[model samples]
Target: MHRLLAGFVSANLFFSAATAKAADLSLDAAPMFNWTGLYVGVQGGYQWSKDRSTEFFTPTGAATGFSQDFQPDGGFGGVHVGYNYQFDWLVLGIEGDADFGRASDGFTCCGGIFTFDARKNWEASIRGRIGVTPTDRLLLYVTGGAAFTDLKYSWNSIEPLFPGVNANVFKTGWTVGGGGEVAVTDRVTARLEYRYSDFGTTRFEWIDGSYEQHPRFHTARTGVSLKF
Candidate 1:
């Protein structure tokens, strides 16, 4: 009976020591993640655009049957500002960015009879952002909202069946896209996102003719941000 009591006491003491060791090695005392802050960043990426145009002139104009489409690819870089609020594993944010570069393409439409040139100097957007953190260091998000850009162009006909026209104007559109981001450091985060912008159609009067453009395009960009 004395031997049995001693064995029970020894077993209890061993278990207590093991539990204490485990407690020291556990992550329960680690710091909780906090991603509530304002951030500013720079981004650079590639964009491919395909824009559609049609005649806005009256039945009396020379362009009785006129249409044009152009596809262009280029690079863009810009800056962005945003705010983020983390709720458990989901994060909500709002951000705005402006990108400037060159996107131009010259093509012949009307069965290669009409020559058209498309040019865009810059673009900007403001969007609502939402994402989920699969891990403490990563975030997957989808963003969308308002987009603005300019469409500048001049198209002339070699045969004069369609008169020459040039226009430079800024238009508003809707954009939507998504991407994944990772926290590279305590105050820095990096991301890659894709967006599709549609400006619908706009009316313009060039020379003696009225015309309209229905434009849309896609963009993919990578950005790095600093949180405050």
Candidate 2:
């Protein structure tokens, strides 16, 4: 009887140790959130532009004494796709996005002698991002790259009575920005970002003369993304 009791105690002790080890293994294997792979998202926000016509030139290339400055502010929305590779606390990624909206403004120069109107149709960017994960689920990053946009300008004069002229320009430039992102779920994330773009100076030829313009803009946007 004593032998049987000893055998039963030994079996119970063995199982108890085995169960404790299994629990420890489970805890050690807990899953962690990772920011790697491809993601696609939609974003929307407001953008404001600052543009200036530095000088008006006659067909003979003589500069007019007047200059015009106009600001166009409006809203825009778009979709973005990107791929991220995470290395420990740092992440590197490439993203592309396109947005369309209206940004229009008009101004009169030289006491209503000359009138100028400007409009923007759409804009896009291809950018590289470098970021750090402050926490497993949060990332802060900076981005910069190429930017493209379409702009239309109209000019009219009264005192001189020059014919109205329209110019449509496609501008290519550079952009830089920064933002923060948070993981809402294992497969979803949210972000907010701001960017500034400069399209440089361009010369547009008109009816009897030409003008020089320098265009740049700022954008603020927010988005939600799905990871794959």
Candidate 3:
């Protein structure tokens, strides 16, 4: 009985020493960034857009030989909110944001008698984000989901040959993009991103004739975020 007790005590001492050594090694390991929190941010960038519209139309709504194309370029800025979960080397999250863009131009097409003005206004999107962390402080990700925006289309008579008409509509579309983010501090991060949005095609009609337009845009943005 005495020998058995002595052996048991020796075994426990060895076990305790092993546990302490393992704990010390764990404490000495490299620290990892915690990305499991809610974040809010603001971003700004440039946007370029292109749209095709019918310039000349047949009296019976048939296609004509002439067409119209317009391209506008400007800057945009906005704010966003998101939540992220990091597991191993992967980070997944969802983010939503909205921006106001300064992109518009006026032109006369078809017969040069009618002038048209197109303005790109407010835009918003909700997207799923998936990324990998090559390092703790940096993330590379791609995002895709639904997008929203509106266009202000206006038409006027430069020579009084046609009546002035205008159309305003809200549009929904699809967007896809990618970005890179870096943690700047314990509670701050910043990112650079690029996205493309397609608003599809639709036709607008007036009292005398009709026209069709297909609109899309590309945006490159930079943002700063605060984590909570």
Candidate 4:
């Protein structure tokens, strides 16, 4: 009887240890998931802009011609904030960002007889981001939304040799882009993105004629973010 009782106690201890080990393994196999939080971060990079000049003939029939090509490239920096939702390996989020930098292009017409200085002071956008994680460490995504820009334009004529003409044009339009992100840690991510924005068109009227133009911008950015 003593030997039988000792054997039964040993079996019970073995079963208990096995059950605990199984429970620990089950916990470890549970799916890892993240999302549903707010995040804010800063970004900096370069922007390339294409600006065009359009001339409108006056009702009195003033002659207008195409101006010089305008292309400007420079650096930009900004901050952004957003909320995200997660479903399995997919993340969907809405974000808002504002950037300040030097974005400008100039146009000269009629052999430098008429010149215009166009500059964009600041810009902002609200966008939606959708990303899928192919693995635990890599994320691929696309983004698009509405954008706004503040622009200043100045023009001067040589024939008449008149004072410079200046106007402040505020434009609202749409933007779209795509990029990729890599996870450096459980809470940190590095990102590279490209975006294009269209500011529509604005018309400026003068004594001789009217000017109609549209301003477009392209940007490439790199940023680091902290995830909750």
lDDT of 4 by residue, 41-154 (tens): 889999988777777687854546654568876889998888878778998999999999988878676678878887877889999999888875777889999999887888
TM-score of model 2 vs. true structure: 0.83
| TM-score for candidate 4 | 0.80
Residue clash pairs of candidate 2: none
Measured over all alpha carbons after superposition, the RMSD of each candidate to the real structure, in angstroms, is: 4.0, 4.7, 7.3, 5.2
Better of 2 and 4 by TM-score: 2
**Residue lDDT tens for model 2, 100-175:** 8888898887688878888887999999999999998999999999999988988888856588888899989999
TM-score of 3: 0.83
- Higher TM-score: candidate 1 or 2? 2
Q: Where does the lowest 10-residue lDDT sum fall in candidate 1?
A: 56-65
What is the lDDT, from 0 to 100, of the residue 61 in candidate 1? 58
Task: Supply candidate 3's per-residue lDDT for 220.
Answer: 97
> Candidate 1: TM-score?
0.80
Which candidate, 3 or 4, has the higher TM-score?
A: 3
Order the numbered candidates by lDDT, best leading.
2, 3, 1, 4
Tell me, by lDDT, which candidate is best: 2
Q: Could you tell me every candidate's TM-score relative to the true structure?
A: 0.80, 0.83, 0.83, 0.80
